[model samples]
Target: MSTEPRSTSEPRIAIVGAGPAGLMCARVLHNHRIPATVYDADTSLTSRDAGGSLDLHADTGQIALADAGLLDVFAALARYEDQAKRRVDQHGTELAAFVPDADDDAAPEIDRGQLRRLLAGSVPAGTVHFGHRVTGVEAVGDRYRLRFANGGHADADLVVGADGTWSRVRPLVSDAAPAYTGVSFVEVRFDDVETRHPDVAALVGTGHLFANDGAGLAIVAQRNSGGQIRCYLSMRIEADWPRRAGIEPDDEAAVRRYLLDAYRGWDARFRPLLTDTDSGYLHRPIHALPAGLTWPHRSGITLVGDAAHVMPPLGGWGANLALLDAAELATAIATQPPGTALTGYEQRMWARSGPLAAAANEGLARFAGAADHIPDHRAEHQRYQADAAAYRAARA
Candidate 1:
């Protein structure tokens, strides 16, 4: 297995996972007239739920979209007004609020599904091969071979792992794995909010409503498109609490009882968020790789997005970082020599994501009550907004 840089004239590139990172990479590579194939395990594009909303920051996410020629399309679909944020205590009393100016588009919100669709549609139709579940990756001479669960295989000169936290391709480069962060969220939703659930709609407001007791309990709700409200009852609990407590994930009543007991002394206004829902409950245990993690560069393979650095959703930086990573990686691949491009991309990614990953871990601990003091999230948002503004100005 030679580790030399392969010819750039027609390097065979394979991107694992069709999430934002992989799709963005393919789109950018296509823009440069470089061809890459993306493999995803899902049967189709809409096979699974696309998750919640995301606020793409100007310096990171927006820049990536602009590079891919999707910024104008993104701006048109983004919810600029929904950038407003509200924080409240357990009693539903307002603690702080930050309403963005009418013209403020520093960080605009877009549905996760919407963003995925935009990126997916940007690439060529046949660029993505669905239903290909990668079972393992092996070095074949100077190239790499990907074995799919469907008894199929494909060989590539270079492999990019955008497969996410539990990426199969990650082990080929690093030994680090995602560990539970001692926090879990039971997600619920309310559909037709303005008509069917006006009270819930008002409670959540135009953007996001965070009701934290500062003692490890919170009801965080965000307004999605189509007048729907998605709520996450977050808590610091045992990783296997559901199974140990004999609470089946689908047992909505049991989960509701557990949440009600956990939040026993909270105000009654927050109950509706837990009880009324138009979707099944999703138990999500937060997990993250070690902060500031780095691995020695290996030729013929590298990573992007969550596959490289996954952290808590503290500042909504996960997807933004992933997008930026894809754009940078694609740019490097298109310009630099094969081996040098992977090495340089890894160095740049490490330097950029290390501090943000550390901060996200700390913010998770504070938000989950591992620390003594309650976090001032509103203040944090203001600082982030100001920093983004400064970044754009400096670049301009």
Candidate 2:
């Protein structure tokens, strides 16, 4: 059940969810001296654990930050030297390594927490109302009334859904829901890798390391700012495999054993990724919305980030696209007439994101199963290079 909103004279612009997209939207609106409020379910910025590092591209993520007057801050916080990427076989044989030049500012790594904090702080105090869990949104006249779980309510002339994968505001504009990909990741963390786990640190190098067996097992380790290495051991299994097998992610011993059994014949070096953990593993089942998803023109509602086009992280375009969406949507709102601005923004967003979403899903399907049939690393490298080139061209 929902309640009707009491009359209020002040007009409001509301953005839901405080992830990168929502925060970026708030920042851009603030830069234009527009009055908007951000609503997030989290009690505080640090209430829970933030995700790992993210690489921001020059054309998308960096451009958005620059528009919000935070590019310099991002540059300062970015891990410029950690742009290297390496792919290897299960036996620890190097497949291909992408080493960026020193002068390259194309894509740089930054901690997700650091980036979110920067965006959150740049906006005016009280602009973001944390702990406001939006329960439902209903149309009231031309505006929308956002009802929260805490019995609080606000009416906004426009509502932007940046609430991530399970967005509450998404149903207003579209009926699309995310479907799980056939892969799942068990995340493991290693602290002070330089001193605590030098072997793993050396193997991971200065940036990202990927070891795949081509069948169903993959170990991906990424170097973070604080001498930390985050590893995700990916496996292709049924969505309910864990529950069916009675595997408890919170049980470290059971997880370690399951991983060891799964990769029994693979290289021994990959053991540390599963064995050397600080605590219980975190299960991350991949999910994505259908490619080319679109909605009918609904006034007073829009979406960004995972809420719009949630795809597997294999393509590394989620955060970048989210930032880009915020930039473009904010511009549309500021420049176009209120009646038609949201429609214009949706058109542009679909044009830009639809292709990327389709490509990402295609890439995921091809790469996830290619290890069995395609053992040649160079071939994989060439395919990746060609795909990347095409994406770059499209962005231009």
Candidate 3:
């Protein structure tokens, strides 16, 4: 549940879910000399960072990082010159590739692990309490009392729900929940992609290589910071495909065999990605907040990241929006009273995140299975590229 407004000498804030959103919220708040405690259900911060590479855009993600003073740290870990793009047919025939102009100031790619570690390390060591899964929320005077699964409790003037899509804290503010977008991803990875898996690596190219027919089948490979290749297989299948197929992600051989059987007629190089796998297979079904999910201001409570507005990862706005939310919320609170800042932040976050969320969902809907919708994908992608460049230029 959400928190009730409380009046404290220090404006105690409780941030849930310690991901990019929660950590950034806490980091920004700490920068402004506000006291906040971060809570996460994970046993530790290093639980699991198994997402693919992410390119921090110039507008949202980069700006937010700069505000948090972690731009340099992000750059130090960024994989510049890894922004190649391409589209191919199901048979692996290259269709189009936009030669990218490389610049050190360009969008720098970082492994999801690096981004999380950097953000987690920046927050004060003792500020975060791990293994504290929130069970419920109760209003106490102007503040809220947090109940933990371990019989522990804490009170705060404000509670920020940075927990992801299935946020336990979200139910308190609004009954809105995330719904599936009829898409699911089978995550695949290759070890030492270059030497060990030359053909597959070559098929992947430098950065992103997508093959699709626009209906349901797609193979997208993204190069990670290390010598690993992160691949995503998109399919329009029954929701119970995993159970029906009896697919055991832990069984690498079975997973590889399944891939071979599924995409049998596709290019041989593309087949080995699933064939020669080093890591376990994983599934992620995209879910998003409805078109315009907003709620009335609930004093002492707000949301950031997926908890606030979950959307598909087409534009990679998940972490970026959370970072921006952190910077904006902290700034608002520092410059005004609790009532004003909390209310103002919610209004702005809802208005600001709606369109980005829509755009992300749109990308997943069209581009997920329709990578080869050539004329359309190319025209749309270029327009976005130009828009991104323009945004960066204008900011500069």
Candidate 4:
């Protein structure tokens, strides 16, 4: 495929989805004095729960934030002391523990809602159109047209699909879709943990706790801001396990009982992580696209983040990769012509994310059975610090 440089100095770019990838792209473009429009399905920024906390790695996620000129603000809101981690067995025995040094900021934790609000605020006002759920993408003569579910239409010179797993613009470039990964999570949260759930707070500590049973069952909890703790009870089960097991999703009590039964051999100490919750249960069936997925470059259309190469959440690489993708794409567009920039961005994104996606898949598969030994979280953090130091040195 060949792309010609736009005759006009500026091209009309339309970005689908206002998640991390889309919003970061818009913010970076704004920093470069380029204009782009973003459309999101949510009615507002607070339309739904923004999920849990995320640790932004220095090399990837932080670099993107620095480029968008929000790193300083992020520092103020980041929780540096929450970098601690622990892993335990079904008997509530500690397998491993890692606590970062006081000065270490390699990957600091921040709530998803706070991060989204920070990025959204960095972009120009009116740049994002909420409630504009896109239905389809159609190719016109030389441009792409977006059809919204609200019977609205818009055409643009370039279309970016940062719409995540079930992207509406993905089919225009590739035929790949996310597939269920044979594992699911029932997510629940406890509010005011230090006061209402002191025991749970102590179990979770300042960061994350992973409790695993050798037989394909695990409970993971992480501390969020506002004195809340979010927990996920995960198991290797079919995608339709709820339906097949005759469990109504809306029935919280039924789901809790089912989870308790499933986790039957585990220590009684782990029960509160499943039973005491301030919010309703959220059933999440994990899914991912094929590892190292790539598509032939099509003119005027491209993808970023999960839309390009979505994999199972392992090592918290998904959001970090998305932030890097947005920063790189925006930089390319600012320095190069439209067509060449899109192609170059795609190639670089594929090369960078392919191996990470493969590793994530392998990591997710480990949940199938109990491992002979647990990973050394301290060693992993040291490696990440070394890598980040090298990256900074090279860039300097």
Candidate 5:
């Protein structure tokens, strides 16, 4: 319920969507002496759920969190020793890999639940209006009004659509919708990795692993926190393929069988990944917004995060970029007046995020075909690239 009188002139801001982008944006604005109300469809912080884990990249995601003064809190939740990595083929052939022992700490990762808690807690007690799924945003007599499905409405001076991929507020700026990327993941999980699924544990080391034989795709194992490994039975199919397969998201058995069929030819080393799954099987179709998707700036409204530009998860840029969006938008608002700050924010956001979106699409192409086409690339690889450059510079 903390409200800072908005410069005694500017109107209140409404940030739609309570995900990373929305929450980070709110936090930055709150820190900058701007009052913003965050809205989400979920009834409470625990209303739905937070997923597995994420590595906060130092450049983007971690930097943004640091800017918001949440880095130490995040570090408290990060699984530092879980940075081990391994990649294997179906025959249990150890591919390129690295897994931190009890001592090594590479790219530490944080559990989604902990990160979500940090974001939700950082905001003022009542700044977030949960269960308020925004339906539409329109200009109402010089003010912006948000119409929710629950028949409630709120007005603000500026409305930001951090609502994510199927953003309701997207139409306010552009008519673009995310296009099918022709990739689907049958997501399965096995909890208590060390104690429960020994075979899968043998197959998967730590950190992450990729097993693709250029036949079918099976990304199996290794997650930070909770001692669980998430396996993805990736398939390239038409947009309607999941429904055609009769896959029920809630029915783990049905989806498991479907994945077993899809990845049938792979090495038996893959069995423990699905055979020991404790969490139910699920189907998730990957989709992406067209790269370079920028719209004309309309006053009193803007888009942020996945609502602004959604791309494949391959780039590891989705959450990190979203968090960065919040940081930049907050910068714009905090450093300048609403009228000027918004314009600067949109311009930089579009410039920065648009290319990353395109890069994501290019990366998605590798995962789109029946056989994986793109070469393997991980965050460590990027780090190595930077390290090599530094080494060369130092040697010279």
Candidate 6:
């Protein structure tokens, strides 16, 4: 409703997917008085849970939000105390612990749902057209046209693909596909932890705890607002193992039993992490595009976020990089004309993302094997600190 006037000379921009990257891009463009339309598959903003919490890095996520004029709102919603972190062994022994100053905002945690709402709300009401799940994108004489699943179509001078990992728009530019990372997470959530599970809450502390066995098994538990904690029981297993074992996602009891058996040697105290799950388990196998992935420049279309360069989430780079991509792409579009802006954006994006993606992939390998290969928690702790510092420095 608050869109700027459409100029005859201004390119008509169509953004696919209303995730952080797309929303941020649109918000930044709107701030520059550039109008763009965002299309998403969801029927409405609250179509589903927005996944778990995220820690927005200072340079990427925070800066992007600032550019979008939403930093103040983000600060109001950020959970500063969630910076507390700990690493432990199967016996629940703390290998490393970091409790940042309560005021630290360098990388504050925020629920993904909350962040999505803030970004979505920041843009004008009608800017995002919900339920417009894009099915394909095609070039039409120097322009791009989008076809949606629900029998809809639109054409734009510029098409921004923010549709995420399995982006439909990606094919128009690249041949890459997301391949499994040999890692899978059985996601479990517990609600009202402070009241219903005080002991678990105390063990989890203020932020997150990583319990690794140094081989192939690990559990990461992180606290969100509303006294809830989300846990991911991760394993390095065959991609089809779940289906092969007849383990359906909705079979919560079966999943719980499987997890308990897989982590049998783990400390008894950690059992509650699996046994006390409050909802159905979700089997989410991690995947990433080939590291350092890039496509030749094609006019009228480009990608951002997971749609551009997806990597394992081990290095905490996914959301941060996505937000950065959105901001950078928006800046490029705002300054350059349509045909040439994408080249500049892709060049800078690849330079910035290529190394990060490679590092993230390597780090994920180490992280997946930390329980099995790492000699000791102390060494892992040191590596964690070094990686954290390095990421901060790189961003700085």
Instruction: Evaluate model 5: give its TM-score.
Output: 0.88
Q: What is the lDDT of residue 72 in candidate 6?
A: 91
For all predicted structures, in order, the TM-scores are: 0.93, 0.91, 0.90, 0.96, 0.88, 0.91
- 1-396 in candidate 3: lDDT tens per residue? 332334446668899888888888788877887767898888887876537898776667777787788898988898876766788888877788854555534455788888888988988878788889988777888777889997878888788888899987788789998998888878878878778988887788787887886667787789997798888888776656777889764666676676677777787667676666676778777778885578878888888888989998776678777888888888888888877987888887787789888888777777656563443433444554576577558746
1-396: candidate 4 lDDT, tens digit per residue: 211223366688899999999999999999999999999999999999989999998878998899899999999999998888888889999988888888988889999899999999999899899989999999989998899888888888989899999999999999998999988988999999889999999888989898887678888799899899999888999999989989887988988888889988988888898799899899988899988888899988999999888888767899999999998999898899876999999998998899999888877777556655566666776777787678678858
lDDT of 1 at 210: 79
For all candidates in order, the CA lDDT equals: 0.87, 0.83, 0.78, 0.88, 0.75, 0.85
User: lDDT tens digits, residues 82-185, model 6?
Assistant: 87788889999888777775455677889999999999988887999998888888887877778888887887888899999999999998999999999988
Question: Which residue pairs clash within candidate 4?
Answer: none
Candidate 5 segments exceeding 4 Å error: 1-10, 99-107, 247-251, 368-396
3 or 6: which has the higher TM-score? 6
Q: List the residue pairs that clash in candidate 5.
A: 84-99, 84-100, 84-206, 85-98, 85-99
Summarize candidate 5's per-residue lDDT along 1-396 as a digit string, tens digits.
222234357678899999889999999888887888998999988876576667776657776887899988887888865555555566667666554445433346887777778998998888898889888888879877888888878888888899999999999889999988887776778778788877776666666677765544657455756677787766667766657877654666776677677767777778767666777666678888988788888888888888988988875778888898898888887887767877888887788778878888776665444333434435554663464355346636
> Which window of 10 residues has the lowest lDDT sum in candidate 2?
372-381
Best by lDDT: 4
Instruction: Give the per-residue lDDT of model 2 (tens digit) for 1-396.
Output: 333333366446899999999999988888887778899999999997787889887757887898789999999999978877888888998877777767867778998989899999998998888889999989989888899988988888889999999999999989889999998888888899889999889889987887887787787789888988899888888777677779874667787788889889788777788788874688888899998899998877899989999988865788989998997788778777888888888888888788989878876665566653233433443444565466568757
Residue 7, model 5, lDDT:
39
lDDT computed for candidate 4:
0.88
Worst 10 residues of 4 by lDDT: 1-10
What ranges in model 6 sit over 4 Å off? 1-9, 371-396
